[model samples]
Target: METIVFPFSSKFLWAKYLLVFALFISAKALIKLPINGTIPAVIVFGDSIVDAGNNNDLNTVIRCDFLPYGQDFAGGVPTGRFCNGKVPSDLIAEELGIKDIVPAYLDPTLKTQDLLTGVTFASGGTGYDPLTPKLASVISLGEQLNYFKEYIRKLKAIAGEEKTNFILAKSMFLVVAGSDDIANTYFVLRARKLQYDVPAYTDLMVNSAAEFVKELYGLGARKIGVFSTPPIGCVPSQRTLGGGIERECAEDYNVAAILFNKKLSSVLNSFKTSMPDGRFVYIDVYNPLLGLIQNPQKNGFEVVDNGCCGTGNIEVAILCNKLSPSTCTDVSKYIFWDSYHPTEKAYRALVTLILQNIIGDFF
Candidate 1:
């Protein structure tokens, strides 16, 4: 038989094979893989507990847009934030490698760059009802939802519909409200005393919260995280008002909060069952916060019952933010930053618990 000699040498053939293998490896390495991590954006709605300075731009006395508020931060300048450093939402973004600053919705100066990460519609002293007293021109939950809708529209306009959909579908939705409803409206303002009994009032709060969640789902929020009310009675302002110098928390308010949370959980479970596209998660800030307050030593907190600023009374209005307001030397030692909000250290601890699978099943 005529020998049909190969044109290439053995060395050349080996070299070709090696090149093909290298190419294969390079292609495998270059291919993008689907990530099972958090979404690119986070849309927050609620009260001061999660407010990332939404009230800063507002012409309100309840604003924290001044010095000493962000003292523990890198710049050591207040960014209108309520905490000494960062809040729970800020930490959540940090955990996900997202932006550390959650932009305020009404900030006229906010650029497109700010929107790429996320925005917070939460305002200090805001609640579900519009009937509540206007606390320094803050937005209500309904208004916050409307702002969220506008934000989605703005995102669509910039990133196109597909990108916006992806963001809403995968991004986390955090709602931390209802504390103001109890502290400001119900107990202090006596809105509940006028309208309904304790149990009835709790039902109303939970029902309103459920309705708000439903509205968010309609607006395309998929992964939802709702923070139930903390021990509202344990707040310094409430403690001061509850008794005569004992600083004892009002059990009545605490009981109402418990009932509200139970009902809210049930409503969330029902939503998950009914809405196939929705993922409603409940964050229990009540027990963890209460534990920290009851046992400050266990949580590394020093002043659990009093705020770090002012007279430690129920006077955290605009007057507290005066140019020469009194402030503590070490804010980390205090649980409450003001009468109504938590310190940055406390918020960080709470955020750590939320991100470390303590409430993972709900999410």
Candidate 2:
């Protein structure tokens, strides 16, 4: 269950919302290295799951830099992360001996020194398909790449060309963003599903994703990690939307993810030979997330189906705010902080799984 990696050459792409980052630049935090990891920096890319604080500046309805969203965060302020606290990228960054949270590339207060490590460039409601981001008015994957290009140009201005080049070559990159494709595109709009069945739609996703990974490799990323499609059918929101089935996972969506992930792994493996200089790793989260759902007690979770905020059935983004009817007293016991995103505790557990099982190969 742990080794279904996509397997790229040097540069890669993970397909999930909480994926890789754009640029690293923030003067507020200290730059420190970890004791056991060899990574020089971490770059993130994707949607809300890994957005950091980029969405705060967006003129879209997908923003969540508001109350109760970050009740468990450092100072109880939402930093645009869809989760209760740090997302997976933040935890993985700390594990890799890098800084804790990656700054948002769109932040206006970023300093020259912040470019030395890494920064995030995710947008809420984004996906491999353009229709998803357009519907939510967030940055698309292609737009994120454009931002990455801009980031490289900015880094060249602060650090010399050679130094900037060295940093990018040595840094580890993570890319994630397929849930939106499922939730917003296929299920809600039926745009993609109308033309293709679940299997065909999954193939389309992998094909588009492969192109994105090739684009990243061409941009100088070497060590890349891609997130395998998680069991979106099991998320509290999906359970609610698919006929009010509490805690019961949606088998149809799970089947789509399984098919999509298999094709994604295969496409990535074949795409690698073309880029002999890049290396790709496909990290499977479906099994791990399912594990948490099925054995909540084993994982110390008292609530695995619903979230801690409000009703926890369908509320998300600004809807899961302080204005909600009522929030749970103990967020730690819940696996989810909201309808779709996992709780900070759950993200931490996933990070431990990656560090212990997948991150070793990144070095």
Best by TM-score: 2
Expressed as tens digits, the lDDT of each residue in 1-363 for candidate 2 is 011222222243321211232212222223322333245578888988888878898888888889788777889877788888889888877765567678788877765556668888888889877778888889999999999999898777665565567678768888898888987689867878768888778777888788888888888888888888789988888888863434577778888888888888887777568766777888888889888888888778989888888999989997888889878988989999899999989988877776577655555
**For model 2, what is the alpha-carbon lDDT of residue 88?**
85
Using lDDT as the measure, the top candidate is 2
Please identify model 2 stretches exceeding 4 Å from their true place.
1-37, 243-247
Give lDDT per model, in order. 0.74, 0.78
State how far residue 207 of model 1 sits from its true place (Å). Answer: 1.5
In model 1, the runs with Cα more than 4 Å from the true position are 1-35, 133-136, 322-326
Query: Which tens-of-lDDT digit does each residue in 188-246 have in candidate 1?
Result: 88766778787887777888888899898887788889988989999888999874478
Show the lowest summed lDDT stretch of 10 residues, model 2: 14-23
At residue 209, candidate 1 shows an lDDT of 87
Candidate 1 overall lDDT versus native: 0.74
